[model samples]
Target: MSGQQQINFEKPFIGSIDQGTSSTRFILFDSKGDTVLSHQIPLKQYHPNPGWVEHDGLEIINSVNECISQVLNKYKETNIGEISDIKAIGITNQRETTIVWDKNTGKPYHNAIVWSDTRTSSIVNRFNTKAESLLKKEQQSQSQQQIVPKDYLRDICGLPIANYFSAVKLRWLIENVPEIDQSNALAGTIDSWLVWNLTNKKTHITDVTNASRTMLMNLATLEWDSKLCDFFDVPNSLLPKICSSAEIYGHVESGPLAGVPIASVLGDQQSAMVGQMCFDKGQAKNTYGTGCFLLYNTGDDIVHSKHGLLTTVCYKLGKDSPVHYALEGSIAVAGAGVKWLIENLGFANNSKEIEALANSVQDTGGMYIVPAFSGLFAPHWRDDARGVMVGLTHHTNKAHIARAMLESTCFQTYEVLKSMEKDSNDKLVELRVDGGMTMNDLLLQIQADILGLPVVRPHNLETTCFGAAYAAGLTVGVWSSAMQFHIGKRFTPNPNIDHMKRINDWHKAVSKSVDWVDK
Candidate 1:
C-alpha cells in the first residue's frame, strides 16, 4: 500500500507477419498461444496462362502492411497500445516464390513467380534427365574427382533442383522475361522480397531457411553456393546476402509504423518449426496447406537421404553455429484438392463443406485420388505423373471423391514422414501438425491412424505466424532463443488398432491410382 501509482501489464506482445502462399496474415500473440488481436486479408492471385501463377509484389507488400496495420489498430482499440509496446516482429514467408524488382524504382520487374508456378517444368525435366546425369557422369568418371553417386539427383545448394524452388524460376525469368533482365532485376525469395521492400530497399537479405530453398545456398558453408548459382544461370549480383534467421537485419525506415526494427526471417515451414518449439533432433512436423510439407529436424548432422527425401537446412541462427538440417518430403496437393472442389468441380461449396462431404462416406470405397494435378513430389518426383483417380465406377460420387481427396493428403504425408523416419533411422513417436486443413478432426484422426503415430495439433493452428513472431521476438532481445519459445497444445497419437487395417486397405486403394497419369 506504499505505492501512490502502479503500472499494470506483466508481459510483452509479439507481432508476426505471416506472408503465405494464398494470403498475408498478421496476428498478435501474448506469452501463451492466445490470439489477442488478428486480421488477415486475402490477396489477388494472377493466372497469366494455364500453368503460370503470379502475385503482384506491390500488392503482396501492401497486403502485409495492411495486415500489420490492422492488428496494430485492434491493439490500440483494445487498450494494448496506441503507441506500440510491442517487443519484436517475426517474419515467416512463403518459400521459393521468386520476386525480382528494379533497385532504382523499387518496383517488381514482373509479377512474382509464386512457388506454385510451373513455368520451369520443362527446364526441371531437362535438368533432371540430361544435365544432371552428365554432371554426375563426369564426377564419377574422374577417379580423384569426388565421384558422384549413381542415379544421384544432385543436391543444388542444400536443396533439390525443382520447379518449386526459386533458382530455376529465376533462370526462367532471365531467359523468358526480357523486361526483368533489362532492369538488371534484383531477385529473391518472398521473404527477401518483403525484407527489401520493408527496409526501403536497404536490406537485400534472407535467412538460412529461406535461402536454403533457393537451390543456391550451400548447406555446409551457409553461403550462396556459387557452383549451383552458375549452373542455374543466376548471377551472384541478383542474389541477396545470407543472414541469420534471428538477428536485427534492418529497421523500418518508412511504413505506417516507422522506426520499428525488422528482425528475424524464416521460410514458412521452418518458421512453423520454430513456432511449434521443435528445437530438437528428430522432431518433425507436417503443415497441411495448399501443399503438405513434412520437415524432420536432423539437427547438426547432415544426413543425406538414401531414400527419395531431400536434405535441407531446418534453420540457422548464426554463421558459425552447427547447421541444423532436415529431411523434407512434400506433396504437391493438399488443401488445393479441397480448393479444386470449390473452383473446378463445384463438388463442395467451401472448405468446410468438403469435410462434410468427405464424412458422408464411411470410406473412399476403394477410390484413391493421387492429386498429381501439379506433379508428384518426394518419393515420386514424377512431373509426368499427372493427376488421376482410380476405382471410379458409376457408384462413385462426390462424397467418394471428397473422401479420397482428403485421404490423399494424409496418405501423401504418411509416405513422406515414413520416408523421413526410414532415411534417418529414427523412430517418429508423434508428428506436430498445423495449417488450415489440420483443423479438421476427421483429417487429424485419420492422419494419426494412417501413420500409426500420434498426430499432435497445437491450439493455435497458425504455427506459421507464431514461428515468425518467435524469430522476431528472439532478434530484438525479447525472447532469449528458439529453445525458449513457449508452445501451445499437443495432439497425441491415438489411432485405434482396428483403423490400422483400414489404413492398409486404403494404401491398396492408393496403388490403383499411382502411375495412372500418362508419361
Candidate 2:
C-alpha cells in the first residue's frame, strides 16, 4: 500500500526475483519503489534424512517462470504499463544453498542442498581435523599459531569452517554424488542457478555477495580461491565466474520480460541492507525471516570479527564501484521457530495468531526457549546444540511457551547485536528491521525490550525484494539514486524492565541446549 503513489505512465519499472528458502516471488516496482505488480509461489522443501534439507533445482526455475508469468498477466490486466517498460531484472536469494547441474543439458545431478542442511556436519568435522593437522605441522616447523583451526580461513574468506557455508555443501555433493565432477558439472549458489536458467544457459555468474558466502572466494581479490577449492576438493572449473552485485549480466532469454537485462544479483541479506539504505558505516539492519540476520555496515574496510560474527561483502553497486563490507551475525532459527510452534507443538493454526497468544500473557513466567533445531549459528557455532525449552512449570501453558518462542528470536538478535558491537566497535543507535516477522508489533516491542535499542520497520516490508529492485533499477537508470522509504513503525525500549538478567538467563538456556547430540 505504501507504493500506491500516482503511477507515472512515462516512468520505467524494475522486477526482482526473490528466490528464498521457502518461496519464490516476482515483484515489479516502479521508479518510486511502489509495487506495480507481484506474484509469489511457495516452494516445497524435502528432507529425505534427518539433518538434511533440499530443493528441486528445476522446480525453483519453473517457479520463478510461473511467478513472472502471473505478475505480467496482472500487469496486462491493469494496463499500468507495457511489458517493455520493465527495464531490468534483479535476483536476491537464500545464500549458501548449493546446486550442481550439467553445463550442457542443464539437468541437476541432485536436489539443491539447502543452506539449513546439516548433512555435511561430518564433512565439517573432517575438514576441521585436517586443518588442525596442517596447523600442527606448521607449528612444529615454525612459531606456535594463536588462531583456531576452524577459523583458519576467516582472514581469507571471512567465514568459519562450518556446514552452514556453500563450500562444505559443495564438498558433500562432490563426495556423495558420484556423477558430479569437473567434466560436465557446474556448481554455485541459487543466484547462479537462476541466472543460468533465465538467460537460456548463456550466462553463468554469481555476484560478490553470493560468492562471499561460498567460503571459497577470496574476499580481497573477489575471485575463487584455489587453496579453498583444494581444501574443499571442489574443482574451480565447476564454479561460476564472480561479478559485482549490480551490473548488466545478461538478458532474459524468453517470457513476458524477454530480452530485459538481468542487471543485479545479491544474497538476500545483503539485498535487504541496500533496501534499508544503510550505506553509511555503522548503520545496521536486521531481517527476521526463516532466520535472523543482523548486518553492520563497515563501509570499505573488512573488519575481521574478534567475536563470532562474520565479515562479508555488503554490496558492490557496479564493476567499478568500491566493495562495501559489513560485519554479520546469523541466527539459524527465527521464523522457523514459529513454524515449529504451529506444526510441531500445535500452539496455533497460523503465525499471525502467535502475537495474540503471546500478548495474552503478561510474561513467559521464567520460561526460555532455545530453538537450536539445527544447531546454533553466529557467536556460538555449536553444531551439537539442539532445541531446548527451559524453565517450564505447571503454570506454563501455550501462551507462555508462545511468548518464549517470540522472545527466543529477540534474545538471539540481542546476542548477535552484542557481538556485532564488539566486532565493529560502534554501538548502533537503532536497528532497522524488515521481513515477515516484523509485521508482528508484539515481536518488535519484545525485540526492542531485549536489545534496548529502537526497532524501526520500513514503510515497505518488502525490502529484500526492493533491495534487489533498487540494484537493478539503478543499473538501468529506473532511478538515479537510492529511494528512501519512510518508517512504518518504531518501537522504543522500555526503561523499567531489566533486560540484562533475562539475557543472562537466555545464555544459561543456550548452554543447556549445547552438546545435546553426542560427538
- Reference-based lDDT, residue 179, model 2: 84
Cα lDDT tens digits for candidate 2, 318-387 = 9998999999999999999999999987889998899899999999999999999999999999999999
lDDT of 2: 0.92
**Candidate 1, position 118, lDDT:** 78
Best by TM-score: 2
Candidate 1 — which residues are off by over 4 angstroms?
A: 1-10, 82-84, 129-133, 136-140, 143-156, 318-321, 481-519
Best by the lDDT measure: 2
TM-score per prediction, in order, is: 0.91, 0.98
Tell me the tens digit of each residue's lDDT in model 1 across 187-272.
89988888788888789998888888877887788888767776666789988898888887887777555777777788988888
Misplaced by over 4 Å in model 2 are 1-10
Q: Give the TM-score of candidate 2.
A: 0.98
